[model samples]
Target: MVGRTNIETGKVTRETALAAFSYRLKTAVAPLVPCAAAMERLHRGARHRILSKGDHILRAGTVADEVFFVHQGLLRYYFNDPNDGGQERTGQFFDEGIVVTDAESFLARVPAKQNFEALETSSIIVLPRTVLNAGYDADHAIDRFGRLMLEEALVGSQRRASRLLTLQPEDRYRLFVETRPEIARRVPQYLIASYLGLTPESLSRIRRRIAGQVG
Candidate 1:
């Protein structure tokens, strides 16, 4: 956590910064496999950020120049459909020890096409794309870290895509609980409903039905 506050930036070091970073890195299977020097480089680029609930970490159509590792709380990645009176759809939920990024934009070095917002007050470590790029140039270990991270992200996206196409809403909810029960408990019901592509009432009914079966 970062502690000291910058009067101008409204940012403070929450004191658990380094520990949180370490925790996240441990969960990052690829980053941890890198050499010691690469790990050092990664830590150097990390800066702690404390955000309030509803903060916009990444807005749609903006340049994505950094990647964030969640240290605490939850975040939701959502997009708006302008054509149909600005309907919102959540695409992803990120919790502690997770990395969240707009896939195409972060890698392609283009503007992000999606928005990421904190679902609760959150803490994170930010690493700019420039720093990561330089680290990759300096060490083969760091390059491998980057590649592995990308591969993990790709696999996650594919899983979500497949679920959206093939699974019914109830099956999707069950699979979500099976895969990310912690997130299901921490995130709001509405966001979970959005992620499962269901309305809140429908989710409620599904939950009741499932509970009846279990009982």
Candidate 2:
């Protein structure tokens, strides 16, 4: 899949990429108050970039100077646990149409604790921090958009933390599958297991058990 996507990505021209990104940006801001000036400011600084599968867009100990909007493909946000032999724990997945960034790191001007990696060949729009900040100061609608994005990110983090603290492993997996069936299908089983805080073997057993109940 990665190879196929890379080939397709190589064929995309700058003009084509910018047009697609423009459409996505417009779509995202459509529900908010329309501000042509704000839109133009955003469009002026945005540019397209492509990452092959396994590429890291952001790494630990580095400040997130840019925000990414996923125009195509999948990305994983994860961190290494020193207490657990540096084992990687998946925190979140960003698919098409989602914004990707380490919000705390970006906002506080601190090094990021997590990393963002491409799980599949990905096309993303890169928005520099300067551009976003300028937009916030210049337009009320843009400021509202930024605030809403951060709020959503916070809510997602809180929900994931709550689920991990309160839900059993099997229940977590079941709920994840029920709510994010597309991600369950698209992501590898092992990675999904990690995201659910389960060993692959345990996740396999849970899957078999669920299948048996269905059958």
| Strongest candidate by TM-score | 2
TM-score of 2: 0.90
- Pairs of colliding residues, candidate 1: 1-15, 1-16, 1-17, 2-13, 2-14, 3-13, 3-14
Cα lDDT of all candidates, in order? 0.78, 0.83
Scored by lDDT, the top model is: 2
CA RMSD of each candidate after superposition: 4.4, 3.4
Candidate 1 similarity to native, TM-score = 0.84
Summing lDDT over every window of 10 consecutive residues in candidate 2, give the lowest-scoring window. Answer: 1-10
Please give the lDDT score at residue 131 for candidate 1: 79
Task: Tell me which residue pairs clash in candidate 2.
Answer: none
lDDT of 2 by residue, 1-215 (tens): 11123435377544555566555555556666647787777878877778899999999999999999877779999999999999999999998777779988998989999999999888888889999898888877677767767877889999999999999999999999999999999999999999999999999999999999999
lDDT of 1: 0.78
